[model samples]
Target: MVTKSSSGEPSSPLSHTDVASGTTGEVVDTTTAPPAQGTAGAEVQQTPLNIAELNAPDGNAPVEINDDDDSFDGDSAIGSDVGSDTTSLTSSVLHYKYENGRTYHAFREGQYIMPNDDKEQDRLDLVHHVWRLILRGELHRAPISKTVQRVLDIGTGTGIWAMEFADEFRSTTVIANDLSPIQPTWVPPNLQFETDDAEDEWLYTQPFDYIHIRNMGASIADWPKLVTRSLENLQPGGWIEIQEHAIEMHSEDGEVPRNTVQWLSEMEGAARTFGKDMNVAKNLGGYLRDAGFEDVHVDKYKIPLGAWARDKRMKEIGRFQQAYRATGLPHII
Candidate 1:
């Protein structure tokens, strides 16, 4: 169930009618610190991350990203492969529309609940930036080699991560799929954006060496099936990495405002009525294990809800993140 936050906003990620889910890590500020004027927010700040820092573990020198273009001439269709008779992408051009004071996806209609306008895009970029900082600039934690071939990024919002990955690894083919074709037209030739749904059957000519999923907690209806498909489509010894966090408001000291609790209770009740579980992240590991994934590992990180950190960078990051949660959650709720 979703919990109360100072913002009085929903505490879940995008919604999956079946389950629910966070930020950089696990959390709470318990030093008897007075709660912020509001409940709690899982916001992320805009972080400046570079490809050089990600490639060099020694921090030896910055590796400039090669933004050169390539010519693949392969199938650029995202969902429902083109050559395959049984697979075909919906040829509808999704437009953007405004509703209830927020922007929304007009292409696939309500296939996704989050807005795709500039406001939400900024938040998505900020969320991406914060995670780069939390993960220390690395794109992913998959145990793969430098010699990667085909790579797929599911729900590639804005295609920022995919563009960066393509820029960093010019030799690798990166296919970024999303429900809306909102990515910039100019990008590395190695990277291509396609309009597709991750929940649907994946169609591609070749198998991928690495599959990456992030911040899709509220978008998927059946995560286990997705994982099973990942396992089936991946080449031998391939690895799929999932990054997720919890949404419930937590505190080590257990000091919470009763009013906030009341607020959270009511909000959760509404979510329950809608058939969306706000506690989805708690079961991700179980889903991976149930899908027959070997050596599945889950890492936990506790992120502060606001600018309550003692660390200089974390504190700055926390402030931006707080703004992100405030601005972004409304689009989803």
Candidate 2:
């Protein structure tokens, strides 16, 4: 299993592990995704159902957007500038530096492969909404009791989840980790942000009681290894919930058109070029199993595009998710 290196070259074979992802063996094209979205249901979810409602809440009314590629649905646009002591990104006093008002990390150079700017923030916000919708406004699928303390938020983009969880679980100390210091400085006392790579060897003084990783989408290079790391870093009988999405949009009616499929395929290929797999969400359960996780639960949902969903709740989520994709597309491309 050869993966792309930082320099855009294919590296040596990876360890032979059972990769049980639902990739469909679809051959992806090399062409860049178009600036305009196609009408196919596969890539057809590029228009915002209600951008005015979302963008209007803030001072920015009727947001200006462009059609790019994919988003975190968000990068993990994974770039950098840095703090002098904390982020050890290439020992440049800062792991990341800003280019064109967008932050990119220096350590892995192109490791993140996205821009950390306002557009990305919008995507991140959208991704959070999508997850919250999926989780039914709750945090985790794990049957975690209130007694669980010492939480870890891996790939904690924007630290939204961590801060929320910390506020809810006051007894728990939430440690958020990511490659960039993009988290807010004014965080809850229990919540702290760390600018580091979760894919690297984890060195923590204590094991966490609960771990949450979400919307990391291709940010992590080794999925199974991260599962193992989570298992090791977690306390006995601790819970870890990994919530993400499958890149291959599914439709039971076979309505997704060929052009959209090709566009989505092309997007996946671009991510793979960065050594990350956008389709890894479906295989996370298998990875947890490979890591010897017992009582692992796998839940899959078919989130609809646009307002075509039958259920009211799903329709609302689709509306948000649709707008999110629209806001995110330009940044990913």
TM for every model, in the order presented, reads 0.70, 0.70
RMSD to true structure for each model, in Å: 15.3, 15.8
- Candidate 2 Cα misplacement greater than 4 A, ranges: 1-101
Worst 10 residues of 1 by lDDT: 29-38
Writing each residue's lDDT as its tens digit, candidate 2 over 54-91 gives 12121111211112311112113223232124433346
Segments in model 1 whose C-alpha atoms lie over 4 Å from true places:
1-91, 258-278
TM-score of structure candidate 2: 0.70
Q: How many steric clashes between backbone atoms does each model show?
A: 12, 13
Candidate 1 per-residue lDDT over residues 104-160, each given as its tens digit: 665657767777765666667776776676566777765555677888898888887
